[model samples]
Target: MKVKEVTFSYNQTVEQLKAVSLAVEEGKITTIIGPNGCGKSTLLELMSGHYTPKKGQILLDGKAIQQHSPKELAKRLAVVHQKNDVPFDINVERLVAYGRMPYKRFLHSPSEEDEKWIDWALSITNLQTKRKKKVEELSGGERQRVWIAMALAQKTPILFLDEPTTYLDLYYQFELLELIKKLNREYNMTIVMVLHDMNQAVRYSDWMIVMKNGQVIARGVPEDVITGERIEEIYGVKAIVDYREDSGVYVVPIGPCQRDE
Candidate 1:
C-alpha cells in the first residue's frame, strides 16, 4: 500500500496529518513511531481505508483505496484497532467467526469454509481451548489475541494494528510482539502497525516511518532512521542510540531536553 502526499484533518482548522507520503513495503513489517498526538493512528486509519484523506491518495495494488468495495477491501486487508469493544458477552469462536462476514450473504449462516477459517484463526492464536470461553473471562493479553484471531479469520494478506501494546503489562507486551513477529516470519504477511515504544519498533520493524507533528520526518530501516540526534529532535529527549552485538540496535533515553537547548 502507498500513501501519496496525503493530508487529513478532523476539523476545518487543525490538520491531523500534513502532506505525508510513504509506501508500506509488501511482505514485511512496517512500523510507524512517534510521540503522542503525532498522527500515527490517523495515518494507519487512512491506509486501512477507514478514513479519506483531504488531499492525495492511498493506493492498494495500483488502484485507489477508495475505489474498492467495502467487502473487497475487507477481503484484502484486516485491521485491529487500538481498542476493540464488545458491548455484549460473546465467546471466542463466535466472535472470531465475524471475520468471515465479507464472504457471507445477508442473514446467511457461516458456511463450512467459514468454520474452517475460524478454527484456523483460533488455533494460530492458541485460543482453541478458549473457544467456548467468554471474552470477559480472559486476561488482557488473551482478549487482545481474540481480537487478532478475528482479524486472522479474514484471511487477508495485509494486517493493520494500532498501538496494540498500549494497555498490556510488560510480559504481555513482548508476548504479543513475538506473536506479530512470528506471523511475519512464518506467513510472510504484510503487516503495518503504529507503535509508541521506540525500542520495540526497532526490534520488530523491517522498515520504520518516523513522524512528528503530523508529518513524516524520516523513513528507513531502524538503524538508519533512529538516531540520538533524531530522537532528541523529534521527541525532545536526549537519548543514546547504541548497538550491542547480541541485541542489535537499541535506544537509551537519559533525560529530557531543556527549553534553551
Candidate 2:
C-alpha cells in the first residue's frame, strides 16, 4: 500500500494531514507513532480509502485504490479500529461471518468456502469457545479479538489496526501482538498500525514512521528511527536505547531517563 502526497482536512479549513507520503511494503508490519492530535489516524484512513485525499492518491499493487470496486478493495484490505461497538444480539460467529459480505451477492448465502474462512478466523483469534457468545458478554480483550476475527474473515492481504493494544491487559497485549506477528510471518499479511507503546511498536514492526504535528519526522528501521533524540523530539520526553549483542537491535526504555525527575 502507498499513500502518495496525500493531504486531508476536517469539516472546515484546518488541515489534518499535510502533503504526507509513505509506502507499506508487502508482507511486513509498518507501525506509525506520533503525539496526540497528530494526523496518524487520518493517514491510515486515507490509505484505507475510508477518506478521500484532497491532494494525491493511494495505490494497491500499483493500481489506484478508488479504481477498484468496493468488493475488489474489500478483498484486498481490511481495517480494525481501536474500538468497535457491536449489537448485543449478534453472536461472535455471526460477527466474523460479516467479513465475507464483500464476496457475497444479494440473496446469496455463504458457501462452504466462506464457512472455511470464518472457521479459520475464529480459531486464530481463539474465539472458537465463544463463537456462540454475545460480544457484550466478553472482556475488553476478547471483544478486541472478535473485531480482529471479523477482519481476518475478510481474507484480505492487508490489515489496518489503529492502536489495537490500548486497553488490553499485559497478557492480552502480548497475546494479541504475538498473534499479529504470527499472521505476518505465516500468512504474509501486510500490516499497518498506530501504536503509543513505542517498545511494542519497535519490537513488532519491521519499519516505523514517527510523526510530529502531522509530518513524518523520521522513519526507518526501529534501531535508526527510535533514538533518544528522536523520542524526545517526537514524544516530548527523553528515552534510553541500548544494544543487547544477543538481540542485535536496540532495545528502548531499558533505563530511567532524567526527564522522569
Candidate 3:
C-alpha cells in the first residue's frame, strides 16, 4: 500500500495526520513507532480504510483503496484493533468463524472451505483447545490471540494491528510477537502494526516508520532509523542503541530529557 500526501483530522480542527506519506513494503513486517498520540494508530486506520484522508489518497496495488467495496477490502486487508469488545459472550471458534463473513453468502452457513481456514487460524494461534471457551473467559493474552485468530481466518494478504501487545505481560508479549513473525515468514503476509515498544519494533520489524505530532519523522530499515539520537528526538528520552552478533538492533532508554518547546 502507498499513501501519498495524506492528511486527516478528527474534529475538523485537530489534524491527526499531516501530509504523511509512506509505502508499505510487500511481504514484510513494517512497524510504526513513536510516542503516544503521535498518529501511529491514525495512520494504520487510514491505510485500512477505517478513516478517509482529508487530503491525498491511499492506493492498494496501484488502485485507489476507496474504490473497493467493504467486502472487497475485507478480502484483501484484515485489521485487529487495540481493543476488541464482543457485545455478547462468544466462543473462540464462533469468533474466528466471523472472519469468513466476507466470503460467505447471505443465509448460507460456513462451507468446508471456511472451516478449513478457521481451523488453521485456531491452530496457528494455539487456541484450538479453547475453541469452545467463551472469549471473555480467556486471559488477556488468550483473548488477544483469539482476535488474531479471527483476523487470520480472514485469509487476507495484508494485516494491520494496532498496539497488539497492550495489556500483556512480558512473556506473552514475546510469544505474540513470535507468532506474528511466524505468520509473516510462513505465509509471506504483509504486516503493518503500531507499536510503542522501541526495542521490540527494532528487533521484529524489517522497516520502521517513526512519527511525531502528525507527521512522519523518519522511515527506513530499523538499523538505519532507530538510533539513540533519533529515539531521544522522537520520544524525549535518553537511550542507547546496541547491536549484538546474533541479535539485531536493541534500544535501552535511560531517562527522560527536556524537549524543545
Candidate 4:
C-alpha cells in the first residue's frame, strides 16, 4: 500500500496527520514507531480504510483505496485494532469464524473451505485447545490471540495491527510478536503495525517509519534509522543505541529530557 501526502484531522481544527507519505513494502514487516499521539495509529487507520485522508490518497495495488467496495477491501486487507469488544458467551472458534463473513452469502453457513481456514488460524495462534472457551474467560493475552486468529482467518494478503502488544505482560508481548513474525515469514503476508517499544520495533521490523508531530521524520531500514540522536529527537529522551554482533541493534533509554512547553 502507498500513501501520498496524506493529511487527517479528528476535529477540523486540530490535524492529527500532516502531509505524511510512505509506502508499505510488499511482503515485509513495516513498523511505525514514535512518541505518544504522534499519528502512528492514525496513519495505520488511514491505510486500512477506517479513516479517509483529507488531502491525499492511499493506494492498494496501484488503485485508490476508496475505489474498492467494503467487501472487496475486507478480502484484500485485514486489521486487528488495539482493543476489541467481545460479546458475552462467544467462543473462540465462533468468533474466528466471523472472519469468513466476507466469503459467505446472506443466510449461508460456513463452507468446508471456510472451516479449514478457521482451524488453521486457531492452530497458528495456539488457540485450538481454547476453541470452545468464551473469549471473556481468557486472559488478556489469550484474548489478543483470539482477535489475531480472527484476522488470520480472513486470509488476506495484508494485515494491519495497531499497538498489538498493548496491555500484555512482557512474556505475552514477546510471544505475540513471535507469532506475528511467524505469520510474515511463513505466509509471506505483508504486515504493518504500530509499536511503542523502540527495541521491539528495531528487532522485528524490516523497515521503520519514525513520525513526530504528524509527519514522518525518517523512514528506512531499522539499523540505519534507529539511533540515539533520532531517539532523542523523536521521544525527548536520552538513549543508547547499541549493536552487538550476536543480537543486532537495540535501544536503551536512560531518562526523560525537559522539553519546551
Candidate 5:
C-alpha cells in the first residue's frame, strides 16, 4: 500500500496529516511510532479506508483505495482498531465467526469454507480452547487475541492494527508483538501497526515510520532511522540504543531533553 501526498482534517479547520507520503514494504512489518496526537492512528485509519484524505490518494494493489468497495477492500485487507466493542455478550468462537461476514450473504449460514477459516483463525490465535468461553471471561490478553482471531478469519493478506498494545500489561504486550512477528515471518502477512513503545517498535518492526506534528520525519530500517539524535528530536528525550547479540536492539531513555527557554 502507498500513501501519496495525503492530507486530512477532522473538521476542515486544523489538519491532522499534511502532505504525508510513504510506501509500505510488502510482506514486512511496518511500524508507525510517535508521541501522542501525531496523526499515527489517523494515518492508519486513512490507509485502511476508515477515513478519506482531503488531498492525495491511497493505493492498494495499484488502484486507488477508495475505488474498491467496502466488501472488496475487506477481502483484500483487515483492520483491528484500537478499541472494539461487541454490543452483546458473545463467545469467542461466535465472535471470530463474524470475520466471515464479508464472504457470507445476508441471512446466509456459514458454509464449509467459512467454518474452515473460522477454525483456522481460532487455532492460529490459540483461542480454540477458549472458543466456548464468554468474551468477558477471558483476561485482557486473551480478549485481545480474540479480537485478532476475528481479524484473522477475514483471511486477508494485509492486516492493520492501531495501538494494539494499549491497556495491556507488559507480558501481554510482548506476547502480542511476538504473535505479530510470527504472522510476518511464517504467514508472510503484510502488517502495519501504530505503536507507542520505541523499543518494542524497533524490536518487532522491519521498517519504521516516525511522525511528528502531522508529518513523517523519518522512515527507514530501525538501524538507520532510530538514533540518539533523532530520538531527541522526535520525542524530546535523551536516549541511547543498546545492542546485544542475544536481545537485539533496545532504546534506553535516560531523561527528557533540556530545551532552551
Candidate 6:
C-alpha cells in the first residue's frame, strides 16, 4: 500500500496528519510508533476507509484505496482493532465465520471454500481447541487471538493491527509478537500495526515509521530508524540505546525517566 502525500484532519482544527507519504511493503511488517494521540490510529483509520484524505491517495496493488467498494476492501485488507464489542454468547467458529461476510450473499451459509479458510485461520491462530467455546469466557489474550483469527479468516494479503497487545501481561505480549512474526515469515503477509512500546516495535517491525505531531520523522529498517536521539526527539524522554549483537536491533528507553538536577 502506498500513501501518496496524504493529509487528514479532524474537526478542521488540529492537523492530525500533515501531508504524510508512506509505502507499506508486501510480505513485511511495518510498524507506526509515536506518543499518545499522535495520529497513529487515525492513520490506520484513514487507510481503512474511516476517514478520507484531503489531498492525496492511498494505493493498494496499483489501485486507489477509495475506489474499492466496502465489500471489496474487506476482501483485500483485514483489520484487528484495539477493542471490539463482541457478542458474549458467540462461539469462536461462528464468530470467525463472520469474517467471510464480505463474500456472502443473502441467506447464504459457509461454502466449502469458506470452511477451508476458517479452518486454516483457526489452525494458524492455534485456536482450534477453543473453537466451540464462547468468546466472553476467554481471557483477554485469548479474545485478542480470536480477533486475529477472524482477521485471518478474511484471508487477505494485507492485515492492519491497531495495538493488538494492549493491556496484556508480559508473557502474552511476547507471545503475540512471536505469533505475528511467524505469520509474516510463513505466509508472506503484509502487516501494518501501531505499537506504543518502542522496544517491542523494534523487535517486531521489519520497517518502522516514527511519527510525531502527525508527521513522519523517520522511516527505515529498525536498526536504521530507531535511535536514542530519534526517541528523545519524538517522545521527549531521556533514553538509553542498547544494541543486541545477536539480533542487531537497538533497544531504546531503558527507562522512561528524566535526568535529575
Q: What range of 10 consecutive residues in model 6 has the weakest lDDT sum?
A: 250-259
lDDT by residue (tens digit), candidate 5, 147-255? 9999999999999999999999999999999999999999999999999998899999999999999999999999888899999999999998878888788899999
lDDT score for candidate 4 against the true structure: 0.94
Q: Which ten residues in a row have the lowest lDDT in candidate 3?
A: 83-92
Give the alpha carbon lDDT tens digit for every residue of 42-156 in model 2. 8888888788887888888898888888899999999999878787699999999999999888998899999999999999989999999988889988999999999999999
Q: What is every candidate's alpha-carbon RMSD to the true fold?
A: 1.0, 2.6, 1.1, 1.0, 0.9, 1.9
lDDT by residue (tens digit), candidate 3, 1-261: 999999999987799999999999999999999889999998999899989989999999898899999999999999999988974888999999999999999999899999999999999999989999998899999999999999999999999999999999999999999999999999999999999898889889999999999999999999999989998888888998899988878888899997668
Error of 1 at 239 (Å): 0.9
For model 5 the TM-score comes to 0.98
Stretches off by above 4 angstroms in model 6 are 252-261
Error of 3 at 6 (Å): 0.2
Residue 254 accuracy (lDDT) in model 1 = 96
State which candidate, 2 or 3, has the greater TM-score.
Answer: 3
Estimate TM-scores for all models.
0.98, 0.93, 0.98, 0.98, 0.98, 0.95
Return the lDDT, model 2, position 128. 96
Tell me the spans in candidate 1 whose CA falls farther than 4 Å from its real position: none
Clashes of 6: 0
Error of 1 at 156 (Å): 0.3
Clashing pairs in 3: none
lDDT of each: 0.94, 0.88, 0.93, 0.94, 0.93, 0.89
Residue 194, candidate 6: C-alpha displacement in angstroms: 0.4
Provide the global lDDT of candidate 5 against the true structure.
0.93
lDDT score for candidate 3 against the true structure: 0.93
